[model samples]
Target: MKSPALLGRITAVFRQSGAMDKGKGKVTGVIALTLGGLAVLAVLAFHFPQYLTTPDLRKKYDVAILREIMLVGMVIAGGMALANLIRLRNRWLNGTALALILLAAALGGHRVPVDDFPDNTPYVGLDWFILDLLGSSMIFILIEKLFPLHRDQPVFRPGWQTDFTHFIVNHLLVGLALLIVNFAIHRLFGWMVWPPLQKWVGGLPFFAELFLVILVADLVQYWTHRAYHEIPFLWRFHAVHHSAEYMDWMAGSRLHLFELLTTRVSILGVLYVLGFNQTTTDIYIVIVGFQAVFNHANVRVPIIFAKAPLKWLIVTPDFHHWHHSSEREAIDRNYAAHFAFIDYIFGTAVKSERRFPGKYGVLGDYMPPGFVRQQLFPFTWKG
Candidate 1:
């Protein structure tokens, strides 16, 4: 027979094991459910065209079905997150919140009549949904693991309130400003030079034209990005981006409206000069946008070949993180948007053996957060 002490110890071990087993079960269930919902979304996305074109379904089912699907998806994702939270892990809450917010936006905003719109873009369609949600999430997760601007910083650190405010303003307010700026520039330039430029460039093959367009746009971006660092006047607007103490998907979104306008206007000027066709421009926009976020992400890539020839061809997280580091050694290096070759050729590339940055955010330790203040900062703050 076991002694009383031994029996008590055995009971405690069993209890602890049971708790671990429960947590594991919850994790598995949450992952499975999330994946299952994604699968459903994919199916809906693919079949959306067929469903929309169907005379009976189109006549009977209104856009409300899309809203319903989105709402239900949000609830499912929230439940999965709640389940995971009950297991005592709060890390998954961000993913859950992302799902909820995106679904709500889609359901509410994607109600325009299909025929009346230029193209029949469906809200719940798999491509847009994946692009917005999964793509952004991947960028966020990658940035968190790679650059880790806030590796030593906790969530509620003194600067976090500012960081959070910057985040909300960038997403909610500044994004709209960028749209206005892009449209304005495009219209202004379109009136002056678009016709002649279009005739000249449209004669090239699609792939060739695309390559030229992207190259031109990236070249413009390279200079604009460099200017942001060198020119004190522009640095004020761009500082909102660099002020981040932590890097994530949303970190890339934390730019002031003025910064957004300046950057977009520069790129738009190039697009107008090049006269890229709509398809080429669309593809370029998608690739550039995704790469912009991905390069700044915290995702860790293996170091084996990442340091060799690969570093010369493409911008890796390892390379870009150095750009964000506060260390004197890393400042003012690796500014290329798409190709690492540009940075290498320009002598801005910095090679590292380590997988992640030692430190991140602005140099000199002086940074502020709030979106409104960041937008109006240079005018007001002495620093």
Candidate 2:
């Protein structure tokens, strides 16, 4: 069978009642496939660290812990597959999962030693991709389950494959993306870097520096984001992100490559020119990373005290969701990423009566479905 047909058939199992039903084995089979698949990729990264693993990420994480995680993933996937085989359920999915796990084992599994490799070797961010995916899925999925905006939203919702493909591509290309951003900053904005100003900015108190960096970065993003809505040419690339009809954690990953490069280059370029302290910049990265995923997440946080004050201070899922809505009032509104007050100050915040948006995605829904198609859409689309 074709790949799409096979994927459709497998995903259909997830739509059934009570996905955790042990007898059906559908959920377990999917889990096995996911874990098994990541294990295989992890093994490949181990074997070809020079070409696959990221240098920056390698220094930060413990090899022993990652190896342990790989081992546990293999064991869980294999055990689930075996159980499914015994129950005679989801044979295709479970069998394929088992095959992948065996393949990973044959390729030295987690035992593949990482000999000293040249750090300058051109590479993808495979290690970053694996770690971030594991971390985000574990944290965000649990959050969504606990405080779900749409209670019935499944783990494997429609358009997930497309969003996941986007996620994988974006993560794997992190090395290249960083390279581009660094190169652009140095070449284009080097003249803007005044040592005196940088020193002054760096000498600020830790909290002050943190607040300044976030505000500056968000200001750059705010204008860039607004342009993506107001400018027709830029909208072509931005539309790919807005095409995600569903509002979930993974929905935020459905971004076009052009948009990704331009946006990062723009925001990071400004930050570089400002020259915030490295420590503050690092913390800002962690904060921005967490909030980026959290805002787009299906989870909702209920603020009992100072609810109105907080909504005006920072962006929340409820606030950002309005920005993604296709409704007439929401179009080109709520463009701020970090601070809700930016929108309120600029007269762009949505003033709707209802709490959340009824629909998501582009107004006309002209964007295509697949990753490649969506990426090419900016150039090819007539309107």
Candidate 3:
């Protein structure tokens, strides 16, 4: 009974607005709980690396470094929880955090050893999801706070649960998504690969190859994105993303699974056919990953991006936000993912007197809420 009550309190705290009550220790309590919870998950990941970790990521991770990180996280979480307990503030939250930390320590904490494990074990990308969530929150949240457009918008704004669920599901299924994309690419586009062209393209200077990669990929993305608006069936799949009324870093993750799979297959398929070097492709992935989150972030750039020419050359938050706008001037426009110029050249850039749209989301706001329902939306949607 006490455990259920504590859990309920934690959930209520999370569901509340992001504004912190430092005097009540609510801020520290939340941090303690978050870090302590992640520490427990980290321990499990360490204990069951074969089943919990990503194979590709495992190859690159240094166990020593990860161990040190885990140690620091546990120490901070424990310290915060203990401090709050001594102060007798937010006792339920801090108590729960301490309990999680103790449980993690009891289960071997960060000291859990990793021995030999079999290759190709079927696994969800739990490690990937955890690390990425931690990293993205630290980086993007800081940026949004420093250069905020919607100053009143809280970090845990309304609909954050939906977006966070999307992020978790998409990341956890990264293995499956890669598998599907690789299979489709090899089976369907293998013959399209011209060796001489691939060799030539791969041999280009690194920057040149990277530029070409972005250009080619963004072109495919532009057309695919436009189709999602111009075609009724495709719009249903895309509407799940546009249903996010609030713009933030995590909001970009609210994509329907079908759209995610098809879009990745289409863009990566073209890149595969082109046969760019692995290094260049890796760099492009990093760029795309950063921009995807950054452009959706509730951030405002004061000077450089205010210029029209630069906005046309690069996809900024201002530019991408317009694509998510419900206003008539912005509807079905600004489709390019990386290069804003792609939209301009295609005559799809938004024409507006206002600096930003007054409203966002689909014009009619027809889409349903929640993760499962949104995924099922594309299939069941009548309009």
Candidate 4:
């Protein structure tokens, strides 16, 4: 037998050689595939502008739909390529990466020309989805990477099906519901004897009016959100939102449609009563949109600063994560929408030294996925 030192040296050499070979192989494969894919996309973009820019071709096909199709396809292809690369440890998956690059190019290539819309008209729906939701998704992803709430949790995991469904219904489907609710509220409020109310509210300065609108809306939302927790009748619809096991940007979109409509109508009632200007109302919506999603995100802010002055003005991730927690103490606290001060003033604030919740999701994991079941949940006795 070899001496102890010699045997140790041999083992070390074997381990080092294997690790080095694995590292080098992975690096080489990633680089070769990425570069080869980008080169092909560059060539196609330069030579085949017609396939992308031709109006006749685009008219026959809805570019937005096609873009979504290609995006999904590319994502699947990239996933498969990455999986195969890991499984085989082979450079041949470079071709699969090239296919992904081409798919990505196709998705981005078919934007309708700026001149296609009338000079004054703005693109809506999918254009807004691409610009706003996609941009927000990227920002949230970056925030999670840079300032993760739970460092142990994987940032991008395999549990996105529920989150994706939530996003689709909450962001896209809710628009129609909001429109109907807004119209109905306005008509109903118009018949009321609040003529003087509008005149007074409308006379306020723009910034002041905007602040009031937000405050009023948040007040309504504060109560509505609280009711969703306190009232078992409403908890069913609300539980669907709390069903998310992980918190991220899209997590806020998991609310049930009935819950969404009820909450929105309450806020809209406040808006109509306050007679907010369209511009101010629009700005308020934008601010609330960012706040609603951001507060629920899995981001870590510096504790010292976040708990100090900032805590009074705006709801941070720490404040909102507690709301999502199933902890008994955190159950009814932090009910404020945009401001934590509301919770404090109302005696509902629950303070914690820990930044992130140990556990999330509803107290009992009873809710099922899908819109219809969630809508009917509030009335059912299964809670």
Better of 1 and 4 by lDDT: 4
lDDT of 1 by residue, 48-107 (tens): 543223222233444566555545555656666655556655434324444544554454
lDDT of 4 at 228: 91
Per-model TM against the reference: 0.65, 0.93, 0.97, 0.69
What's the ranking of the predictions by lDDT, best on top?
3, 2, 4, 1
Kindly give the stretch of ten consecutive residues in candidate 1 with the minimal lDDT sum.
12-21
| Candidate 3 lDDT over residue span 225-308, tens digit each | 999999999999999999999999999999999899999989998999888988898889989999999999999976578576
Model 3 residue runs over 4 Å out of place are none
The local lDDT score (0 to 100) that residue 78 gets in candidate 3 is: 94
Which has the greatest lDDT?
A: 3
Off by over 4 Å in 2: 1-22, 303-306
Clashes of 3: 0
Relative to the true structure, candidate 4 reaches a TM of 0.69
lDDT, model 1: 0.61
Give each model's clash number: 11, 0, 0, 0
Best by TM-score: 3
- Model 1, position 152: C-alpha lDDT score: 48
